[model samples]
Target: MTHISKYRMKSRVEKRIKDNFLRSILSGGSARRQAILGELLTQTEKIMLAKRLAMIVMLENDFSYYRISKTLKVSTSTLKRLHRHILAGSYRQILTSLTGNRADAIIRFLEKILEFRMPPIAGPGRWKFLDERRK
Candidate 1:
């Protein structure tokens, strides 16, 4: 859970300032970026960021809401919001960055990680047949 200050800011930062900050972060080398993020984000914040990215990746892979919810322990409402963002094409750049050129390989790997075992087929009739044959 993130804690936001109750006090509102008197003024919002300009878009250009925000864009410049983001650009500076993105322009760094991978190690520098990792170091900056490590210093900037709290552990909980990092977990939240990872989960959101995972949710987006899983959604793109066509995973069911139930599966994603069960696996990630996130609520359906969160998935719904992300889905809306996805439909709006809000995540295209983020998705591309997350998956890179090996999208198929990455998705396949995520699919394997997300896979769950289904219960074997069973019924009262089958159980009864087995009991009779044993007798």
Candidate 2:
């Protein structure tokens, strides 16, 4: 069996993600995007993406990494990497641009419902735990 390098695989995936046809379909509207996503992704994949988005919103709202990890059942290392991505700015920009003020309102509502407490260090690059599980 041949193995693909991570960088090469990521490039390929990113290329597909940026494809014009895919972009057109995704930009078509919520119903179009939903239909395509439903067709392309499994239920578990959709759920995982939704969870990740929720985590992103919570992180932006100042929810603690540990608290989010506990509530969402995601690893701290995953949260840390996501935090780095947010701080890197692209995801933050996309989220804000896509959701507008509604994102903030929804996050606030979720925070109240989830009852998340702020941790002492919500800053990026603080988590030291490594994800050691093999895929």
Candidate 3:
């Protein structure tokens, strides 16, 4: 395809992705979302997307490239590309919001499981070791 045609096709696909049906399906509860994703995406595609999200979260948590790569089993080049996207600010806000919500949900779930509220971390520096850990 020509460059202009490719751009037009991309835009059309973007529009389709943003359509109400897809939005509503994705916005459903976890089970429904999982079902839809299972039907729509191949297992490999789902795994890759999960890994990408994990990388985004790890990057947001101040994890280093080496640590993320080692833990996620992804290459340095992939991490660099993700870092560029994060730095470019296209996915930063959505990634941060999604990660924050997920973190809160995990904390709540853990609290429910343990039958007690977990103490908050003392300070920002408390999590500095996360960079050193394998994850």
Candidate 4:
């Protein structure tokens, strides 16, 4: 999870900075936005953001908690928190905009990457251990 400092900024100062930051991001083209994010976020932070987006997409699809927890390797607590956010309409606009194929593609891609495991060795039985059902 992303961390915030113990120190707090004044509400007005924070709001002004947040508005400017959002304006900077929203004014950019897709490539520029990607570049800015790539420069600003660490790999772990990027992965966390991606997984959160994937989790939101999965939740919108009405996937069961067990399947989502298993597939995303996220805690039930995290899912529960996000689920509450969803119920409160935190993701309303984004979910509405990403309906149908786009949402499905994101889910499929997330599953593909998260479920993948490297082969243990280069042999006939190399891929056997990669079978998740065996575990």
Q: Estimate every model's Cα lDDT from 0 to 1.
A: 0.80, 0.73, 0.71, 0.85
Q: Lowest-lDDT window of 10 residues in candidate 4?
A: 126-135
User: Where is model 1 more than 4 Å wrong at Cα?
Assistant: 12-20, 99-102, 115-135
lDDT of 2 by residue, 27-118 (tens): 87899887887887777787788778888888877889887887788999989998898888858565766476777776766666566344
On the 0 to 100 scale, the lDDT of residue 28 in model 3 is 62
Q: Give the worst 10-residue stretch by lDDT in candidate 3.
A: 1-10
Which pairs of residues collide in model 4? none
lDDT of 1 by residue, 22-100 (tens): 8867986999889888888899999898889878888988889998898888999999999999999998888777666
> Which is superior by TM-score, 2 or 4?
4
Candidate 2 residues lying further than 4 Å off, grouped into runs, are: 1-21, 98-100, 112-135
Q: Which candidate achieves the best TM-score against the true structure? A: 4
lDDT, model 2, position 74 = 91
TM-scores for all candidates: the values are 0.69, 0.62, 0.59, 0.80
Q: Write the per-residue lDDT of candidate 4 for residues 82-129, one digit (tens) a residue.
A: 999999979888889888899989978867766777886577887776
RMSD of 4: 4.5
CA displacement after TM-score superposition, residue 77 of candidate 4 (Å): 1.1
Q: How accurate is candidate 1 locally (lDDT)?
A: 0.80
